[model samples]
Target: MAPKPPTAVTRPPISDSSLVYVPEDVVEGYQERIETGIDWTLIELGAQHHRRKAINREAIPTITFSDGLINKINRGYLKGFLDDTSCINLDQQWEQILPATLWDNEKFATDEGKILFNGINCLTDDLIKLIYKAVVTGNRDTLWSELKMAEVLRVNNEKITELDVGLLEFKKLVSLNLCGNYIMDIEPNFIPPTLRALELQANHISNINSFVESLPHHLIYIGLAKNLLTDESVDAFSRLPFNLTVLDLSDNDIYHLDPLLDALVRLPNLTSLYLVGNPCSVCATYARLILMVLPRLKWLDSRQVLPTDRSLEPYEAHPDDLRSSYFYFTVFRVMSAPQPPKPEKGATTAFHVELELPLLDVERRKFLLYRRYESLTEILAPPEEEEVEKAISTVLRPSTKALSTIKGIDVDEASSNASNVYDHLVTKSSRVINNFTTFESNKIQWAKVMNFQEPTVKIFCPDLFALRNTFRSVITVNLVYSIVYAKSGKTEKKSSHALKMPTEQRVVLASIKCTLRNPDWTQPSQHFHWDDSLGTDEAIHWGDRDLAVIQYTQAPVKVVKGKPEADPATSSRQLPPENLTCHFGFGIETIRAS
Candidate 1:
């Protein structure tokens, strides 16, 4: 291939009446080259004046410069150069020349008046500031990605640090990528809160704790690889929001992976972790330990490095095992919405799950099953194997298919005796929290039972808070298919409860005077009402008020057997919606530091 002619880098000085024009001979030369029909594509290099097209009310082009020579030059010359050139050198000399001519003693009030200013590259920091300001305050919502400021450097020789890059005008700048730089210290208040993604990989940052604190909570991805971070500042990294997913702490001086692991476990939703070049000797084992602690982790960089080899020796033995044996851990994740009494369109509620198991290490048979629960009360101990087999033989009349599925048991009567486990436990200490007593025990043992038994039932109101004119407003909505044994006989009944209050309860004026503290209620509630005066029937304040239990007001409600009728006197003991509601925003009372 023949060598292409190099274009001369010559830029004319901008003047009020220079009549900046592209030589017509260059366009004619390109046309002649094209007509020759050579194998190589011909490209013309020249600068032409580009006028801004006026926009009409309909956003349609009302008028456009009809200079045939300029249009043809743009289409034929500039298009060819952009298409054929190996690399388009946009960092031209004109940007510097133009800015040098524009900057004067006065601070430019508006970017609009600078009709001749082309933001290509002006070495002066003052000029960049003007461009930055213009980009920020202009009608166009400019993101850092769109503002190609990196290309305008007059000289890359100067040792530029975070202090040197004074982004006073670029206040709207959110995401910044300073991956390869000699930046040492990042001032706390230098960056705007709108900034999110910060990539400062190859920097001499010894103390990133301040940087982490200064960053906004909206930060999603923070890459600080190849830095001189010591163990002393490692704990400060835990202060980052739980929503962070991608954290690259690979090539740092981080030893003793336990603190990092603990911090990782605390994150509610961190899926990807990259810690390859750190001081992790048995990195595989360490990663597995982390996985054992954090069940939700999907990708670990060490796993990608050494696949098929489990880091931990024991877990490596059981290659086929799906469950990680890291002493059971419960993770709470946000749920979609509240389970309403009735579904409403477009209504959203958030929920979180809490794992219910004691973190214990043992070779127990029940530890195999990973049961997810919102609370520990839901766990019921399983029954014994002997009793389970007996129950299976007597209660369950196994069919041919059921008999064939039983392990090691023949299709004869032995198969009928074989119990189906996983559903129920035959343990004595298996306790279910009924209304009598809430499930207070921390541990719930499962029995290797004979027959499959259903789980414990829980009853709750559809919208307990919504129900008015009642005491003990919302009742527990019980779980279905839970069978209970009665002395009369074993009966299958719907696990449901009724909310009833006492009648003929008289309110004494002394009770009101002794009980109410603030005597003012700001929020609304269906439960209690505030009496207007210190001793009058007129009620003023309502809703949930923070008050101390100074005295017992009244035992206003009594439970009646069967479906108890609603009592009018028990109006104060109701909730707004008589159903199960999922609480999302900080527990009922959200407290911030004073």
Candidate 2:
């Protein structure tokens, strides 16, 4: 059979080289031959042309491999055995040839591979090999010694997902830059203890508590920008390592600074802090409040903190404003009414006394004197001439020229109309005393007075001697009086009927004892007085006057039935007089040393 028609020239076994390298070349040669072929009308050519057209219509024009073939190629590429250039059409291949698992392996499996994949342009294989050798040998001293010459390792924008534990074996690495990566979490102990500075900007980290807890105590600077940090997350820094001096947390999701500020105060050694692009940065008083809260911070948001930004110290009141030295005076009035069958023999009469005092300023020499008795309508009524004279004589003696001058009264005029002038003086003095008392009381109320320096005096009914001894600094004394008169209708009725009146309706009185002191007592006493009844038109006392008036007497006055007579038993004795006076007055002078 013509040797079985040459047995169809059984094809030799395909060699591995031809199978691997001749497929694209042979396809190209056949495609060129078919394109330039003659006889376009022959049935076989027509059939071949129809088949070629049909294949072209059914297949993708840009792709030459079948789906199975592409998948096989991708599998090989993912195994790291094939590159983009090995494909016939790289644009037609899947965009990503390597699987996520293979990518992780290539970037994190070995130190040299990680360095290369991390896009660390400044690193060399020599350092990586040394690190590997040190890690395998478990010799930290050797690693530290080798890494001492190079203290920084930056692998920024590397798209690295995980950190190799072997990398942290370098004990001498001081600064580490892993910025712009896809790292989601940093397990504890991933950072070397010797690192002083670490930068982790633009990453997918949400919580850093683990990293913070494992941080080296010597770390001084850290950058954690463009991360998913919140106010709650910042609380992790409440117990930050004391040596961390610089911190950056810009472009985070922090909404409130209160928690962050609360945390920052715990980092006593942190001098510089950055919080730009956070929500708290929009506050107008953010920087001012920060400087106030963090007094030791030297730099904030990359700007030097000025001293003016700090708040002023608390205000303290001055000693003079406290009204430290002051005095007060009180006045009391006593009224006695006669009852039916009044007080026979040794019965004691009862009088009602009322005392009222107000605040005074002794340093300023200010006092409040009684102007008008509120309970007495008599003081407001017209007064009799004799009663006015008596009141004036009691208040202004003949030797009180200084007081007259102070009262702006002419001695001659005052003597001629002593009652009217004295009435005017009393009214004016009351107004002045009330006004000054109110003003000083308001001042004391408004100011922050010192408690220990305030002097207070309270007195009820006491003996005259005890009252004088109570205030030893008093230099002068004066008793002022205001008289009340019955109404016109009442006076007419009393004159017609001549009926006895109750003491409450017949008498009204008030008194005030003013205590005064002069800081400069060396000056001579000045006195001017006007009293026509005393047989002195105008008198001036050159020195201090001692006027003694009996306040009260316990013994009742005794009256004789007839005239005085001699006693027979004792020849030198004489009987008592017909009448006796219950009141007494004495005037004395004090001689001062030159």
Candidate 3:
């Protein structure tokens, strides 16, 4: 290795021309190893443009960008954001892009554009998917028609303190992102009635009591990371109208652990929680308390929580266990997946998972499983001497190799169960509405009696950990998919529900009574390469038969047009397709969130 080349610090000035890269100072110890090829793998320092290939799926309509979101300033419904996208750099000043005077300039017309909208003349639902309207000022009704039609709005990093952005006027708004602002409190009715994902991360929010009770029942993912949340905000968690699957409180002011723990228990559907930058996370027993307290939590901080993170032992004895216990956790990450025009047809031995949705339909499919117990200590605890003997005598015996029946004194799956809760939110292009799913309480152990990769000296509650107990824990899991109707849609018959009602319709195409019997205690945790159960329903196919994959269709909560009422009343109307199709994969132990 030799260091001979001198490097320059700055690159060519940014311009409309193609981007070019320049070299910078070499990182300390590796200064002389630029040419070294380890195992024939050479390191190349280069830069390339991230080309965003357009999605060919018909579900996502192309979002037409107007002059408003372009480099030139325009006076219209869309205000602020001189750049193409909605983002304010950490150190970006407000005056640089969001010029208040430019939007309110007297030169702009004030015709309200009601006639041009209303989907009759210039606008068709197919042509437009999303419109970026930042904030309201001057005349609140200036963009009234466009605002009413908006399903997803980004008002991030606008230095807004009060929740007085006139967002309440949005009738069909579903996903509202207000991250990187100065909001301190979420006033009553501040959130739109139809919102599902409220992203408020990187704000200055502190008080939550004023708005938790007012949050719409269907709202699921709430991002409040990098804010000023405290222990007081934890109580607001109990008042949320619905279960939250993903919550980000990573960098906040919360200090105590018990009150936060007590509050989180109210949200039984919470599977992923972020608390990295808070003071409480620095505690020695932070991960242990959270993993044990919230049995449903899957992702914590930078890694996925595993069986090793949970312990039935007392906290006082946890420090000693921490010194020895070990497992693997995957780092939290975001990946860009661009596929070919059509999926490659060939498939054989490699276990693969794929989801095919209608173009522009922003839908998410997730599969999750956990023991119903809040504290798995009893089940995973060191087995009692007699119980171990019973398991050895009853389940692990050589004579019982072919015996499939259970004896009278075998294990039981009667641990106090907590319901498995996760909501299915449907989004067509920019629209997102709530769809619900219910699961019966079932005994789901996060880990087996013994792991396959371990020195298998661990004991279990033998009578409880018997193979029979595993069979007894079998429960029904349903995989559902549905469609939600918006306010602007009309049926072919021109029914009354389509006239003015905010009705939603559900179509459950797939519901499988799946008892994802885990592997013979060796239970290949996540490495199962089997797709034995492939249920084909046209475009929708189900595979990965290890644990399961599910597409939740909201149970009909309300009736519409002389039927079981369920309507979201969105502006982008999605009439139920005459021919419905879905693709689902189950048994694979992978939970995906969007």
Candidate 4:
């Protein structure tokens, strides 16, 4: 009893799990059966694999999709996915499905499809399929027919060197931006007919004429800034359709304004023009000249053209005005004696007198002198400082007389003998006679006191001058006088006067003041003078002079005598003489031999 109790206490409960052993022959046979079963399964699997491969090869299309075509399909599938409401918030689903559905379809995938997709982005599958069809068939009209809904297309900065004419087939494209590209030349018909605004700025485009000619007639705005453009290219604007209203030509090599302006004139509806960074932009009076020439221009150089700018007149006088107003003067003399020595010799003498006169203003005097002696090139040349100083000096010199004169003398034998007897008297009397012919002799010779000369004095033709130290103001003056000679001791008067002398002589003079209506002598307006207080025309006394004992000569003296009524149509203001010819005269007297 004690041994049984000990055994029960020593052994833990007998284990339920244990390894078993089989006979070697039985194990070998089992191994052989296992190998046979593995071989049978392998054979069946190989047959199934071949059948699946054959099915795949037969069912799949022969067309191979290029990487680009796959990308295009991917983009189009993604766009369609986004457009479908059911695919919202299912981008991961689309990413997994698109490659398998469209891109895997080898029937549509092609190299040309890849190119079409690479040229444009953000298109729908309908458009992608249409474009793919066009590329495959080389039918651009099919592509355009599909893209009729596209209003704008931007392919700027795309590294595109040449434009694809197929892109221009988009019949509904309204705005196009191809700026910031390497595009140098654009082929004709490369722009759609529906495009109204086009931007080709910052491109290597140099054939602006061809580009302009290729533009659609309905285009209203075009930007061509930062391109290789010159004056020649700008002339293309004239041929541009009038519907174009806005143009940008900044940063081009347009040096002359005439061609550009002429081109602009052809654009009647062009109200906005940009020429900043052009050679003509830096010219003086550029805006004014442009506004004046292009009357319809409402905006220029980024600023609005004001009414005042359009109304302003040029500072320089017109050429026709200068030609009509320019004038100068000359001097001559007449002499008479008391008696004739013989019938062969005449009793009077006439000769030309030489005198030096002053210039009116330095500027006008220099202008006239330069115009007379120098070519237009010299006149327009930029003056050096030294040349300016020399001009001033020349203007100040007394030798530079504005009025020129000639001199001569005619005398009979008796007068010559009397002159020898009175040689000293002759010189003194000659000095006295010269004083009478001097500009100072005329009481109303304001030109002397004013120090004014012809052409130069005409400058004051637009100004009012008051008498020195007096409140009385005179607007104009008329220097009316002439010289004549008559035969001494002869009762009959000849119709014509000649240069000769007798035994004695005398002198006559006249001067007067009047008011003129129009001071601008350059214009063709009528001109006349009248007394200011009396409101009547003033006349000069020809015969009333200090010298006496002389017969009147046949010098055709048509003198204005009494106050005459002013012509209603004529201007009463004194103006510079219209004709350039001026006349001055002098006289002398001689007592008879007792």
Candidate 5:
């Protein structure tokens, strides 16, 4: 409701502050004239006409609510306003169905604080027996006829813990306000099928797994505000009746918007909704996601929905640019990888990543954008021609310094059979993701003062983009990288001037997993920094100059540092740091299907 001062009712005997003031119904001339004597024939005709109209309204529900009928009623209402006449006493034509109150166009005000209701009426054992007897015996004068005959009931702010079985007796009940009670669970067969609206707000009720199935199919509105609701409570909403249109869950404990929206998308008729004061409402993409997930909504909270609400510019990469856009990636450099102290393993394969990034849809997905867009192929398309892979070097870049003498550098022998040991070991799923798999090379390196410069990598997954989660503002993707290490061996010195050749033995030091948090467009590209150490408590955060130190998890890694080696004569392990952050990109230079 708008926060305007209440309007005044214009009736002389009674006044309502909530109603807009209008002139009292009055007239002179022919309007006030009345026949001195009534003709029996005319009176009988008038009574018959009135009876026929009333019968038609109830018998033809569709026609009664048709656009023409509603428009006539609205014209009468508008005429009342135009003539400066009051509606305290409505015309006989409208008195039967419409309430005698202010016009909907007139603003009304509510008191401060959460909306509440005060209901004390309830059916007792005597009333139940009387109602049953009245139904069986066709009696009308009993007490049950006077009570429970009304269409609306507000039994709020009570100690009621569950839906009352006796509530099924109200055959004409249209709305039931059971808010501000202790309803922890919902049992079947209690709610009347005729009930159209229900209020379960401000209660101890939590999960609604059974509530969805128990709900009456005719119910169109529900209020579960100010409860202990969670993501689990709304997971079963796909089973809710399709006729439901309005729902209120304001001031609740719903923090996971992904699951909640995923469930709500199945409720096709749901339009007006309220989620104020809930933890999910505070998410950065809360409004955009809600509108995207439920575009049929005509009202959200107190405001009317708008066309602009569907725009996702505030949350994700400009999806409209996908046709012209490209998915690209670059391994700029490992910020501070230590050079292997072994003089032989000069340039070991830094990171070997054999990965499969398939567009997957799983239950309880942490990322909501994936569900909205469905697949990367849908959001992004292949260009008319494929772009060539840039001459990227995942290998170390050539040194800028000049070497006076070049020795018998056997680069091909060091690379040969480098992946023999670690190729057999595979990476399994992590706790958060289930569709991931990886393998690394066996060769390893221990950097003393090795610095990684920007290196180019062939963009493998071109049909990919960052996916955003409703709860977090950043878009992220997961990747696993291995730090290959060389196996220890004694350096054999060649006789005389003939220098000895370095042995080819390799081992996988460790394979680490990382999540790339895409930087916003307004901000400069963020760089990745090598982690000082490895631990479970490590975090992924931005550092100075947009560089972030990634402390990745090693849950499914192939090997740990202290694991036993095949040769006892080999030197002690000199494992390199586990993490490094650098410039990265994933433009679509090449496209592959999963």
Candidate 6:
């Protein structure tokens, strides 16, 4: 039961100061009435005597209280207080409140040295401020409810219009529980970087922009549920670092879904997005629309049913306007075969091609007889175009003597040989053309083609598929280029002429692989190996004339001094070994049969 309210009935009427002014006889009578017992006459007489005795006494009655006074007091408390030898007395019945160690000093024993300290009270602002400091500083690590602190209960759930509660230095504090407060606005300056999990629910926080903007890198989890937020607020969250994985903004005023697509596509790291309470339309059209875009999304709180072809039982009690809408969707996968890489305007062009051989979806022990001729024709068109035409003409002609000769030759062996030839041609052509095409367009035009027939088309059971994989995707297709320089309306191929090949030839095949040695030390008659060797250095000798020799080759070549001369003056100071040089050499040597 609640304690009775403070009133005259509960407490005695005498003032503490007036207690000392009471007469000695009246005090004795009061003490006698307390000790005497079992006399109805004496009890009646005592009650009457007190009323009349008070009138006879001074105008105001006085009651005195001292160490010996106050009957029925807790004896244990009084004995403990009186037994202490360090208790000091001062003027007007007061004592000094000091530590027991101070009793050792004689000077502090004087009445002037005593201090009367005040006790703590509930109605002070100081206590409330102390509670806020203890919580914000994280010194009080226990659950707030367990503290049973009076100030917390009174102030925690109230609305806070003013934020400046002298908490400036605690900006980095984390895991703040301001969930039950009445905070309407979160100004940008108030948000701190150290915050990780902020519980700001059940509050009147309307403008979340400033709060979201001020949050720094360390902040990871944010809960702004059941607020007055709209879809426009999504842009502010999207600009945040992609590291943010969990965001709960359910049950807010978000209408359109388009704003979420751009942010969702980029957040590949995000694992969960809770939109359960946000009242998204769960109709068939909306669910299908969401599925079409977010394929990676695994969780769907908004009921998105997979479409099934089987019919269901009809509803017996359908409403007048109730109806079902069926949605048809078609997802397409399409791409064009990549055209040849566009070559630079004047760079030599080399094209790359890959041949995908026909492999059975499942392996077969032998060729399936049910397979038609058209399927084979489709597989052979890339490489065996000429072979097919030759075979077709022979089949149509059917000359008696020619038929016998064709039967004698193994058709399968011939076809296998032809396929090998095609494979070699394509591989060699691509590599050779790629080498020549490395030069500028002022040089030569080069091109490549790739062809493939079924790996099964072999004379002997060779590992055709194994060979195909090694070179299948190992090339890049580029446009064929032939460098032609025009002078006086006449165009002449330069690289072909420089290569010393026939002008009419479309391609000049040259092996690029050789070994390297000391070219300067070798005689003109000796040939050293180099991986970049293109062709032989044609020597132009002027007969019977002292000629200066200028060495030229199609490979990357350089010449340095054989050894530095002991004297600088005699040393031949040569020009740098330039790739392009116009140094005059011996004139062309012409010899006529005489």
C-alpha lDDT of all candidate models, in order: 0.34, 0.42, 0.39, 0.42, 0.42, 0.31
TM-score of 6: 0.25
User: For each predicted model, how many residue pairs clash, with residues at least 3 apart or on different chains?
Assistant: 48, 7, 37, 15, 30, 12
Candidate 6 deviant stretches above 4 angstroms: 1-156, 165-168, 264-268, 281-594
What tens digits encode model 3's per-residue C-alpha lDDT throughout 308-342?
66665544323322112111111111011111011
Regions more than 4 Å wrong, model 2: 1-120, 123-149, 313-594
Residue-level lDDT of model 6, residues 109-187, one tens digit each, is 4453332111111211244344344435433332122222322111222333334432233444555444434455665
How do all the candidates rank in terms of TM-score, highest first?
3, 5, 4, 2, 1, 6
TM-score of 1: 0.28
Ten residues in sequence with the least summed lDDT for candidate 6: 326-335
By TM-score, the better pick of 2 and 3 is: 3
Candidate 4 lDDT: 0.42
Candidate 3 colliding pairs, count: 37
lDDT of 1 by residue, 1-594 (tens): 998765543322322211112233333332232112111111111000000011112332221112221232233212222233424322232244324434541256356534323322222234444444433454222323233333222211122344423443345555555544445567776665665666666555767777666777777777776566656767777787656776777655565566677666766677777764454312213444555566666667634323332334333212211111111111111111112121123322211222111111011101212221223234466455545544554445233334355544444443332222212312223345421122111211111111111112111111111110011111111111111222221232222321111111111111111111111111111122332233443222223432111122134355567967655434434322222111110011101111
- Candidate 2's TM-score reads 0.31
lDDT of 5 by residue, 472-569 (tens): 12213222333333433344323333222222223333333333332222223334333436453222444334322222232333445798553321
lDDT of 1: 0.34
TM-scores, all candidates, are 0.28, 0.31, 0.33, 0.32, 0.33, 0.25
Candidate 2 per-residue lDDT, tens place, 1-594, comes to 344332232222323212112243243333232223121223224334433443344342322112222233233322122242454232222234324544675756788666544343333225445445454654445544564446776656544555656555456788887776556677665678888998887766677887787888888998887766776687887766788899998756576656688898999898998875564543323455567678889887767776664556532222221111112221111112111111123322222222222211111111112222222122343334545545665554333344566668665454532222222322222112222211111101111111111112222211211121222222122222222223235665667434322111111122222222111112222222222233422222323432111122224434466955434323332222222111111111111111
- Quick one: RMSD of model 4? 46.6
